[model samples]
Target: MTTFITNFLEVFYVLIGLIMLFAGIESFRDQENPARIGTGLFWVILAVIFAGAKFLPYLVIGILILILGLLSLFKQIKPGNIKGIDEKVAEKSAQRLGGWIFMPSVVLAILSIVIAQFTPLGGQIGIGISSVVALITAAVMTHANANTTYHDSERMVRSMGTAGILPQLLAMLGAVFTASGVGELTAKAISGVFPVGNHLLGVALYCIAMAVFTMIMGNGFAAFAVITAGIGIPFVVAQGGAPVVVAALGMTSGYCGTLMTPMAANFNSLPVALMEMKDNLGVIKQQAPVATVLLVIQIGLMYVLAF
Candidate 1:
């Protein structure tokens, strides 16, 4: 079962690579982007890494990642001209589909949850399987042909540009930080100023650290690992706090930071770009107050319940 699941994941990765390769090809053909070569090369490198990383040496992968960084540094990775959606066609489709347009998304969410909970394939495989199923559901509902679907998908991917890969890069950074004992260094630094055994202080420290780290990193999952290791386990959990509660609240606390940061391009910037909003920071502005309140409430809850 594990092997099967592993193989399924590999196939999924390859599919993703192929999609990225297609995006690279499209970028090369786009006359609008002045840096089309750089854009295409970025995606092609990413595609190669995704499809062939397992077979490649770690040093080779590292070099490829450096190349990607250099490309970004030189401002080569721009989102070229994405094909605009036809408004009349979109409106007609919207009128025809109405609420049913959301059905595929609903299926994707519910089916993923069901598979993860009920099947031996686990969450990773469940997500991959559910995504494909949802794609098929969307195709059937829209009565779309393969070419149309591919065109739409490619457009969306191109529109995302570098932000699409930011999460993966941040996650890798988290792993590298943890591996380098950054967590231990953090714990040592914080322990000097604030005593470790105080429950309220410990909870506050963990929660605040999670939020601040997430804000800096732009990813809650990335912040969770480092913060949990550095502050959560040592400061809160070790001090008689409930491990599970601390961990859970720690992550959500990080999400509060996600709501406030521009670094989180997918959550904050993507909507503005997609909707053509005048203010790029509008989403974060709206979310900030809510995130702040939630973070404070979660901190209180963690203090009360985790202990």
Candidate 2:
């Protein structure tokens, strides 16, 4: 019975993903409602990728999905024209919703929290209940405003979709890589080159390394996986510095790296694409000075504080 229930839940998850994908695709076709179309496509892509991860290797699929999502976020792509029928329906929907669609999320959140506190099911059950409540609230809100012509919900979904939970997913991936002992091995290799007894210098070097790695990787997250394993948990901890402080400072220093790399596409490429800049490196060029200054400050601060 337990196995059957678990399998059912898994199947349900896949089904939900498929439904989202299909709805998104359908929404994308409404010519008069470009926003809804974009939103629907985004949801569909998300759902398809998530569902695909169940049967396929998650890491490969995840990387592909991430790349595709990021590419979609590039501002250079022109939106397709919306038709009259789609536009009229979307406008009507928006009018009925009064332009404020997020109201239901707030109500659902409150209800979820309330249920979480009083329910006997504890954390997992409470979370599940809360998600259901939130979904229902959104559905009810959408239905109530069904007669309204506003396509704002679809628009909202599109605008939020690219930024949606991507960072969290990346962070989780980095965590998994870090936990595989790659971080420690990398840290040890680097530490071998430095002499012992120079605790402050070592910490400073680690910070600098983190900054450089972050810049090269275009993501502090990826750098964190490597640096934390190589330097943060091992050297910083072994050197009598607080692990929390080192980890925190290390991450801050990584942001300095974000300023210098084109690989930080979200921070650099997205803006450049949006502005239609002639120079692809325009964002990085502008940010370089500020990033350098910040990096120095972070490295110095961490060294002093850690040592």
Identify the leading candidate in terms of lDDT. 1
Worst 10 residues of 2 by lDDT: 75-84
Taking the tens digit of each residue's C-alpha lDDT, what string does model 1 give over 201-269? 899888998899889989888788778888998899888999989988998999999999999998999
For model 1, what is the alpha-carbon lDDT of residue 185? 87
- The root-mean-square deviation over C-alpha atoms between each candidate and the true structure, in angstroms, is 3.6, 7.6
Worst lDDT 10-window in candidate 1: 166-175
Stretches off by above 4 angstroms in model 2 are 1-180, 195-199, 238-248, 300-307
Residue pairs clashing, model 1:
none
lDDT of 2 by residue, 1-307 (tens): 4565455456546654755564465466755554654455557666776566567777776676666566467632223342234667557867888746776677667766776588644444445556666766776766735422234344433344555546756677667767786766776677688764467776777788888898887878767766777777666767787777788989888888888888889999999899999999999999999988887887778777776
